[model samples]
Target: MAQMNMIEAIRSALDVKLSQDPDVLIFGEDVGYFGGVFRCTAGLQEKHGLHRVFDTPIAEGGIVGAAVGMAAFGLRPCIEIQFADYIYPGYDQICSEAARMRYRSAGEFTSPLTIRTPVGGGIHGGQTHSQSPEALFTHIAGIKTIIPSNPYDAKGLLIKAIEDNDPVLFLEPKRLYNGPFEGDPNIPAVSWAGHELGEVPEGHYTIDFEKARLHTQGSALTIICYGTMVWVAEAAAKAAGIEADILDLRSLMPLDLDSIIKSVKKTGRCMVLHEATRTSGFGAELIAEIQEHCFYALEAPIVRVTGWDTPYPHALEWEYFPGKARVTKAITKMMEG
Candidate 1:
């Protein structure tokens, strides 16, 4: 076992994949020489030659398009889109081409590529640098969505995503890149240097993306969340003195609905939490599915605590973000009734 931060764990995963599979390639803006904007790919270019790890122009479309072509030609290409907010320019290649490649070719062609990007707020990135768009990708078919909250899961799930047969959107919560955040701005940011979640495996590992991890088992209520919201929900539950079953939904697209239903049915209450906007976020789909399966078992209406339906604000970041106070209030309300 090795104690590594999220960035180091991710870089280690890429290093292992590149070394094990000759066909695996990594490329993105500043990923080669500078080692990525956040240094997730730091020193990888020096370890692995430019052929296996190189830099690309500031073109999201071309980056994803070329990855699709490479994957279809039997090479496993892993591309990075600096931030989740900048992925729109490559929407055509991702949603249209890479997503439909297998079905369009009648299973003759498959785009086995991984698209990694940083998502969510809490770093005062305003609107452009911070956005959680997992719902957009989840709405589309033929692709898997992933968001890991800790370094351990980050490394394991990333390795699995890279080896998967279909395209995977691996969204990393930048705020949690070094340490876990629980939506409390008062507390100083923590690093993974000495945290238990930072104790990651040294080599290759895989965490099933379709499985939901039960962080805490309780019967009062169930809290379902992913990414940065997982930590926030836990903090809220603790603050509210609520014994709730917390489930970390590592994968969003191939959602572990069975696990969600089981928890909801056992607890008799459910609250979906996410960092995305409230209207059409992935939390909506989660609530819908829970309602469909656990309606009879539900003791109260399914609740959701999400960001407001407005662009992420630079000055009013916390106001827009659904923080611990917001989540605690929602859980308290649910338990009251």
Candidate 2:
């Protein structure tokens, strides 16, 4: 099997979908000529032609609004906001219009739109360029949010997001775009150990939206996370010599609680980590659910190693983001308790 970087894998997925469906189209700033800021859409315009894969103005709201309209008109439009931080400008469109179209219209209408944007820190893109805004989108009633950790999930989830009838927020981690990109392009598009399986095939695949990927097994502790944190948690487990069970929550809104409960029951101890701020983050919700369903199995209080409740800082960005050291510390603390 040949290896491809995360960016290439995403491009491959989009290429496959657009080729198979005439209704599938991509539009965003610099998406056509420059192939997007990260080049995730590189060569797409050339292959699919400008009408299907074209560029748009430098307006996030306009991009999202256009997508909503196109989706209402029976086209599957994928809009790329240059950065996750900029998505807020279009949040109203996503939450009010795109998200509620189907529910508001009682199935008479739908918004099959996908909003793709690069997120996270570690590349020094600064506060404006790096932000994990999925928590906000996930809180909304109508949209589905997904964050992928590697090349394989990135491709599968993006494809699934595009095809789904609801408006989907596809948060791509910019940090994972570069480097070794360990995913195998020819490896049958199988779901990773802790990844959700989309409806994609070996020739072309789309992972299901609601499943959780279990990466490892252990009776000690269950480390629950998504996006880049999954990889970090695994590394921390290895470094601490702890057999931590890891769960990659591929989809945020339609969370796979079955996976969470099952893991907690086995490990009897749980720790949640994420790049988002500690207060009112996804970890809090998971902790509440675990307390409700798996309280008796708890050997210790559920520890959360998350970003501090502050604006994602510039200089202290590394500290703000949860790392292996913090993860190990949390696990050790749980073990001690």
Candidate 3:
């Protein structure tokens, strides 16, 4: 085991994949020479040479479009979109071309590619760079959406995504890239060096993309969240003095319904949370599924703690964010009912 930050762990995953598989290719804006904006792909270009690890133009559409073609021709292309907020330019290629390649070709061709991008707020990136656009991609069919909360899951899930036979949208919470955040802006940021989740194995490993990790088990209520919100949920549960079952949904697409239902049944209440906007957020789908499977077991109406239906504000980041205070209030209200 090696203590590493989210950036180091991700770099390790890419390095391992590039070395193990000759078909794997890494490319994106500044990903080769500049080593990505977050430095997740640093040192890779030098290690693997410019051929396998290279840079691309600033056009996201062209980047994804080219990756789709590469994947169709039998190469595994892992491309970065810089930020999840900036992935709109490549939306058509990801949703139309790469996602539909296998099904459209009757299993004759598959785009085994992974699109990695930093997502979420907390760095004062304003509206453009701070949006958590997981819902946008999750709404699209034929694609798997993944978000990792810590260094361990970041490394493991990324490797799995790169190895998957279909295209995967790997969303990295930029806020949690170096340390875990639980919605408390006052808490000093701690590097992964001393964190337990930062102790990632320096090897080739994969966490099942369909599994949801249980952070804390309880019967009072169930908190279902992913990405940066996982830490927020944990802190909320503690602050609210609620014995909550916190489930970190690493993969949003092939959601671990089994685990979710089990927890909802045991807890008899559920609160779906995310950093995305509340309207039509992925939490809505989770609420629907929970109601379908465990409606009778529910003790109170399902609740959701999410961002407001407006553009992420730069000056009012904390107010715009669905933090521990909001989550705690919701949990308390649900328990009171």
Candidate 4:
């Protein structure tokens, strides 16, 4: 109903969740007084008080370890890693402890924690600060991975991640923090299955985690993407005059195979795009699944537009990152088939 930036929408979700649940708490470096590096957690400390929203030492491992401890004790803690690239310091705590705790303890314990991190390249943050590491966590069994493309989904999905009873890796694209993408915020937050939108309260609401939302419909080709790439693909579609059907994959794990298959069957041509490196990225997995189900329907080979194989570069950021030209080129090539 109201227009808000991606950052504001995220704060709204966190604010609503904190107000609704005493079990919910937030902790991360600079998240308290500094209000996070990107200010996504701004003013939360004042609203919830320092006890519930406080800063942790500059240790990703310790932050994750403490979150696991809190979740085990029946608290829902939302922890933020300053950047996705730096998440490696806490990888052990996440994969070994937060992820496997429930299975290892035979349901005697569980960690209902949401790990939020700003990810991807475009801001000249260089290799260390910008990395899309979703594939790494998606490989793990116990974690739910998500990357939202715009403000509405950013708010809805973050709320969903916080409420889920397992470790959720919530990756937000830094590039889209103040996006100018076009989408209907009031289009009714329906599940990917076409079910009624989860009734998020005036105070708060959580969208379903496994559903894919179709941003625009077309018959020529389907562009499957998440995070900022969704916006890129849409713009490319317009520039190329290709009427590409855009699907925002709101959830990475428990991917909406049905939506993808159905869309591919109709379009017959598909392109997978992301800001992650081309080699061994999520695009490959989506290609495999689509080929499995829609092979006969496909008119062309599945195409991908992604970053180069090298680390995200500061000097060559634009070249390294896929843009509308690259995406349009890929779309035109796919259309030729």
Worst 10 residues of 3 by lDDT: 184-193
- Winner of 2 and 4 under TM-score: 4
Model 4 residue 171 distance off true place after TM-score fit, in angstroms: 0.6
Report lDDT (CA) for all predictions: 0.93, 0.82, 0.93, 0.86
Query: After best superposition, candidate 3 residue 315: deviation in angstroms?
Result: 0.2
| Candidate 2 TM-score, C-alpha based | 0.92
lDDT of 4 by residue, 60-177 (tens): 9999999999999999999999999999999999999999999999999999999999998767789898799998888888889998877778888999999999999999998778
lDDT of 2: 0.82
Cα lDDT tens digits, model 3, 86-164, are 8999999999998899999999989999999999998999899999888888888899999999999999999999999
Misplaced by over 4 Å in model 3 are none
Of 1 and 2, the candidate ranking higher by TM-score: 1
Task: Give me the displacement of residue 226 in model 2, in angstroms.
Answer: 0.3
TM-score of each: 0.99, 0.92, 0.99, 0.93
Considering only N, C-alpha and C atoms within 3 Å, which residue pairs clash in candidate 1? none
Determine the C-alpha RMSD for candidate 4 after optimal superposition of all C-alphas: 5.3
Q: What is the Cα-based TM-score of model 4?
A: 0.93
* Candidate 1 lDDT trough over 10 residues, lowest sum: 209-218
Model 2 agreement with the true structure over 1-337: per-residue lDDT tens digits: 3356677778888888998899999999999978988999999999989999999888888999999999999999988898999988798899999999999899888999999999877666667876887778878999999988777788888888988988999988877775421122222333233333222243477789888888777778899988878877887787668897899998988999999999999999899988878888888888999999999998889999887887777887667777767777777777888
Q: In order, how many clashes per candidate?
A: 0, 14, 0, 2
